[model samples]
Target chain A: MDPSEVDVPPLKDLTIDNITDNVKLINSQCPDPRLKYLLERLVQHVHDFARETRLSHNEWLAAIQFLTAVGQICTDVRQEFILLSDILGLSLLVDSIDHPKPADSTEGTVLGPFHTHDAHSEPNGTQIAHDPDGEPCLVLCTIKDRSGKPVSDVKIDIWETDSKGKYDVQYEGREQPDQRAVMHSDEEGKFWFKAIVPVPYPIPHDGPVGKLLKLLKRHCYRPSHMHFMFEKEGFDHLITALYLRGDPYETSDAVFGVKESLLIDLGTVNAEQAKTYGVKEGTKTIVYDFVLVSEEDSRKLREAKAMAAMKHLGLRMKLYNGLPVPEID
Target chain B: MDPSEVDVPPLKDLTIDNITDNVKLINSQCPDPRLKYLLERLVQHVHDFARETRLSHNEWLAAIQFLTAVGQICTDVRQEFILLSDILGLSLLVDSIDHPKPADSTEGTVLGPFHTHDAHSEPNGTQIAHDPDGEPCLVLCTIKDRSGKPVSDVKIDIWETDSKGKYDVQYEGREQPDQRAVMHSDEEGKFWFKAIVPVPYPIPHDGPVGKLLKLLKRHCYRPSHMHFMFEKEGFDHLITALYLRGDPYETSDAVFGVKESLLIDLGTVNAEQAKTYGVKEGTKTIVYDFVLVSEEDSRKLREAKAMAAMKHLGLRMKLYNGLPVPEID
Candidate 1:
């Protein structure tokens, strides 16, 4: 239909008082209902943010320039936008909201920018460290269902930075898939791999996200931890990390990915204990167990979590009923 | 101080319950107190927006991708980010906040992307329309101060689209400028020029902003209006528009630029009146008077406005004492 032929609603003068209505009118023509809703909510938030801050035109222009720089800096190998989200603590917040685990199941964290599909599958207990300049470490883990039954034949993807606190991808001329491997749980739901102990590392700070962090006077380091992703046929996929206990950054992870339950002790092993894992003396060992929720249980948990969030938000809205709330038809 | 040498505060795991604290920690290092405050406020609003919408990871990714595209599409002549801001009503909001007018002074609208500094100066009453296909229009205006005193020798930069509803820049292989000129008010603060009545025009929508507008199902037409920028020493610069009263999009400008006070009547002129202005009969004529504010008065108004905003925001914060309020120090 011709928009001009139909009676279009009069556009309100763009003022702080009518910003919400103007946004709604502009978005009224959205063909997709979901997109319309999202746009409407986004518009209201953006307008409110400006009003709350009494944002200046210069500040608005600065934001535009910063975002433009972020886009210009992005390439196939780099995603500055995602990095911005990570540093803003948004990545972790989205992860928590999307992956609400049952009491017995492993809690999820951010699927950081480093994970890749090209990681080669390696046998259980295979050595993952290539240039072993750091302390030798052995990682052992098991996967079990919420009912306490061993979940065999599960894929576990493990990755971490090298001893010097640099991912292989960060090197200029490094080979693909360094310090990363995909391992499957054996018949007993057991998996193990050899690698250097992970260390706190700064995220790539040479780009716009890094510049923003510096301007904000915030550090750019993620805590010492090993990223893990577990998947099986009838269970919810879990992406998590095992943060090393006592690591300085463990308490202040830049991405806010750490959880108390996810922290594990990194114990020093004697020669005899090291020999059992076919490693030299003074090697470090970390053992962790992950519980997976069944798909049905996960769905139920998500529903309950969403309902709770709605109730919570509803209560909060009552406290500020005078504030404009976007109509969501 | 070396961040590594000094004992740093422990990082808290990112959670909904601790989002406010996490934001504070991230901004702890900001050297500029004002920037620190802005960042903290920005972080709170962003997190709250996500929670209010229950924004999903997929939705967040989509936003990241969209912003990246907007940045990527920008060039020397094209600014997709600004267009996005205009469509979302942010440009107008920012303009309104920054250019608050007194009761007697003219109000400002959006400084659209089409504005250029390359317009050449012409004598008062000079005809701006080089090619005469459009209906002839005669613009007559006078400039005065808030005290009703004539303010002469002011530079009046005027621009509008032609009969075909396209700017010179929009036409491929066109001249440097068309239908745009800078005129000086006479000793009596009177100015007049000859041009065509501007027709409604669409904003450049072939780019990312246009694509977004299409997705949102909103039309992209701006109402017929003539842009004016008045400048003189010791006076606050005025940027405004004289919108035609009966234009179809006058009530619903795509950029939300229309104000009732800015609208002017376009009346038909008789042969005798046309001869007086040295124009043909049946020409359209528009007469308007603009009021300027002194720079000192503008400064005082801004100070008062800022103080009022601070007081208002303080009161609002009291209503949400339970919510996270960024620490000022």
Candidate 2:
């Protein structure tokens, strides 16, 4: 369709009233149909936002500088933009939208910035905490399919900060990984590990994201939680965290990665009971179960939901003279 | 006023529905009241834009990367972000909003990237074009106040590209500034200069902004025009351009800085008239007039208009619990 056919002000002598139209004109020239659509929508929104706030030139300059700093500070090991997104709750929002689980399945959260592909594989019930100064804790988790059947041979990667609230990666002098491990579920779909109870920690705040948090008068503490990634051949992958029930930051997690179902209680077990789990007496024990949905079912559900939402929003999929046209309200 | 008391969704377990609330929460922590208000409005608009487009994680990543590239490419002599803004028509939009001139006064346009603070001061009718290959043109301009009285001793900084459409700064081997001169108006408010007629030229296209233009299927040509910055002790400063009437790119100026009143005809002059103006026979001569408003009057009018607009938008200036509160719609 001719973009000019739409009701828009003249591009010449452009003012705030016609800024969106001028942007749309540029967007219409994009070679890729999907890119064109996305750019057009982006232009409309950005222009509207500027007009609504009557954004000053100085404010816009500040934003540009802030974004530039965020980009310049980023490296292979550091992703400040992602951190910015997480703190603003955008990362979690996107995660939830992209991974809507069934009622009985595990919910997903942010992958965070610390995950690595080199987690050391360990045997069941092996101790992951090499530092003896940490408090001993025993973790036992089960994995199951939607039918309540055990899902064997599944990989579970777990990582967390130590009792002092420092991840192994955060240490400048450390050369080896600490307090993290990868384990395979047993025939019974059960895996056990001995480690220190994870502690609440602040995200690295020396960067632009940290500066932004300080400016916002907000703290950078995330609730104590164990990061878990579960994967198998036929099931959908899950990147989530198990939060301790009583952590002070649980309700005010800086990244907002918490969900009601992800919070679990850690019970104290006596020596005799702990001995059975290969840990000392008075150790904390966490027992939790995770359910997985089939990959095919998950994909179908996501597509169906997205389609319904688009329809509800008055968007239609149609072709206009060989161009893909998204009729949006 | 207490921000929490405002009608907003909870930030916890933030979904797209609560994204704006989370943004507002961050905005509320701003120490400056004006900053707080601006940030809140910005958050609302940005969040709305994201939701309206249903922006994906990958799309967001692409945008972040694009902005980073634009920032990284900027230097003391180069401003890719400003170019991006100009091409997107945002710069012109902001200029128009900030400078609302009276009907009788000359309109303003973009200052562009070619302006420098070190233009060489020259006498009346000085030849600015040192290159012997260029076509000689004579320029005569008059400056006056809204009352039709001549405004003497007004400084006018004039700059333009050479006949080949290359600015002196664009040359890699050139060491001295070319085709630029600063002059003052005579007792009759008349200023004259001899230079080459500027040719339409393309903006620097090797940078990220250029790449974006190509991706948008748009050219990078700006219409041939002479930039002028007029300043007087008691009058508001004016930055504008005088466009050659028949340039092919006049209607499609890449920066959208053109206004109807800025277009002027360059007439051919005979040898006698050209010699009188100290140029060769068959030389082109441009005659134009500019009017300025008093600085004090301009400031008062601008402030009054802004106040009225703010009032009409349901924004009020009041104190809430001893703190300044701007109630915006």
Candidate 3:
């Protein structure tokens, strides 16, 4: 060592030692081989990060406050943070990385937080209930393959909110479960149902998540829509919601559930066809076709079909029916 | 958009008969052009994965519950979830990518959450009052450069719990800070302090974070030790803690802070050296040296560094005369 450079440690040196040593001791307790390596690495980064930023106590406290607010806003019915997750694209990102779909399919979208699996399955074209009302419309739809062939005898689980923006399960007071049903297609993969065009509604604002939105200066409204789940032998099962086009919430639909492909044209039909279809014919009618994508397992489909039969079991499936492949000729 | 496939209606085909016919509606409210494509690819995968695993509602709920529990376990003093992050190897994985510490520098590790920004900065060789009664030991240490040259006149911040594992700040009804002090190094890059060997201690157990560990059936303790944060210009500032090799809690620290490299021997010393220093020379002494790595800036070391520092502000920073680079060459 050069005598000209007499060793001189500064006050900062002492400050550094006060922290580095404890960090070393705490990290040493890790036993999980993987965890130990991870702890050591994390501790170093955390400590270094702290020192670099010259972090202060009050700033740390503010962070704690932000997190506490985030917690206060969460509830069983409203998960603003989860919606935040959707916006950040993390939920869908994780979902995609884990479940890549085939190229030719009716592309799946988000399963908004409002869905409950316990919907009552009804017979083909059976109406679930009547509560509130909107523009009465007829659903004239067919199920088909990519090749345009009819997929016979498919199942469609359907549910929607009443015109007042309330679901059958979300409200409780005067009446029965309104605006909900499950339907099965006939031999030609065709079915028609009676319903009213949905009305857009705001999310439940009676919770902490709602309060948080107010604090953040954001909105909590969703576009009017109906939910559907479709499955059949040898084809992919899909979950999606159909949105009303004219609704102002069509763009900033709060839950981010809109897609161009799912919007159907509910053109005014003459009163004649509405009556023939049980509704007054020529009344407003929306017509669209559902397309199913092929999958790897047909036996799973048969099992799903069977599970649909055993509704008393709370919708339990004895086995999973995978997508059925085409019989390539 | 193929002509032979499902017909792609021309702009003319889309009319204003109803708002649904407006082509601009598809692009505006759903303003993000890429959103549909992304969600389409993601949701299909998520649903298929759920089907493949036959994932049940109960299992899914449990998974979400576990994540919530992890978040609930974090606090200023205890960060079990951070340990979980460490053990999961995510922290180190991030550290590896972000701060590739300059080779030949202090090996970095994870920074557990209980760091304080400002500590008492005392003169070189100041005695830190650990407790009124305990064995006397002299900490003789020198901070040196990479070329074995000493850093003259640098300060070392020192803090350690009493023999019973209690820092002055942690004791109930305590009047003044105990055992912890900010001290400067002499011109010879050397420092000496009087204290008893610190004994192992348990972490605090009276908070929600603690209640969680009890429910999980895990123990809560940390090995006895001292904290040190070493810094100098033309070098990276390091935050580290040394682990007492033989402490009872060595293997079971709840915060997971421990490392073989940071452990010290605290071997027995004779009366002559003790007398030479100050005491009757019969006092026990534990001597150790701190090693720091070189770097450009400590703040930008990692993203988390900025986060931890900004967490608090009023924490103190003790300025020195000036930071002169130690002559390593």
Every candidate's DockQ is 0.44, 0.31, 0.06
lDDT of 3 by residue, A1-329 (tens): 12122221111111232434444443343333323332333345445433433333333334344444444455454454455434323333333322234444454455555565555677655555475456676777788887778888777877777778877656645244457766788778887777777777766556544543343334566667777778776776666667777666565554455666766667765666655666665566667777776755323443453344334324322331232111121
Model 2, residue A108: C-alpha shift (Å): 2.8
Chain B TM-scores per candidate, in order, are 0.88, 0.88, 0.61
Compose the digit string of candidate 2's lDDT tens values, residues B1-329: 22223232233555657656766774576676766766666566555545545555566667766776776776555667778877877667656655668889998888777787778899998998877777778898899999999999999999998878877877877677789999999999999999888778888888888887777777778888999999888898788999987777776777888788999888887878766776667788888999988987776655555555556666674433222247542
lDDT of 1 at B219: 80
* 10 residues in a row with least lDDT, candidate 2 chain B: B1-10
DockQ of 1: 0.44
CA lDDT, candidate 1, residue A115: 78
Encode model 1's per-residue lDDT on A1-329: one tens digit a residue. Answer: 23474345788556768877867876776766657666776787788777766677778889888988998887655678888888788888777776668777888998877877778999987998887587788887888998899899999889898988887777777667889999999999889889888888888888888888777766788889899998887788788998987887777676778898999988776887677788877678888999998877875666566556657767332111112223354
Question: Better model by lDDT, 1 or 3?
Answer: 1
Model 2 misplaced stretches (Cα beyond 4 Å):
A1-10, A113-140, A150-197, A226-237, A266-287, A311-329, B1-11, B111-139, B150-196, B229-237, B268-278, B285-287, B300-325
Q: List the candidate 1 regions with Cα displacement exceeding 4 Å.
A: A5-7, A25-34, A121-136, A153-157, A162-164, A168-175, A267-283, A315-328, B1-9, B117-136, B152-157, B162-187, B190-195, B231-233, B267-281, B316-328
Question: C-alpha displacement of A229 in model 3, angstroms?
Answer: 9.3
Task: Give per-residue CA lDDT, model 1, range B121-163, as digits (tens).
Answer: 9998788877677888888889999999999999988989888
Estimate, for each residue in A146-238, the C-alpha lDDT of model 2 and write its tens digit.
999999999989998887888787777767778888999999999989888878888878888888777666678788899999989888788
lDDT, candidate 1, at A294: 87
Local error of candidate 2 at residue A240 (angstroms): 3.0
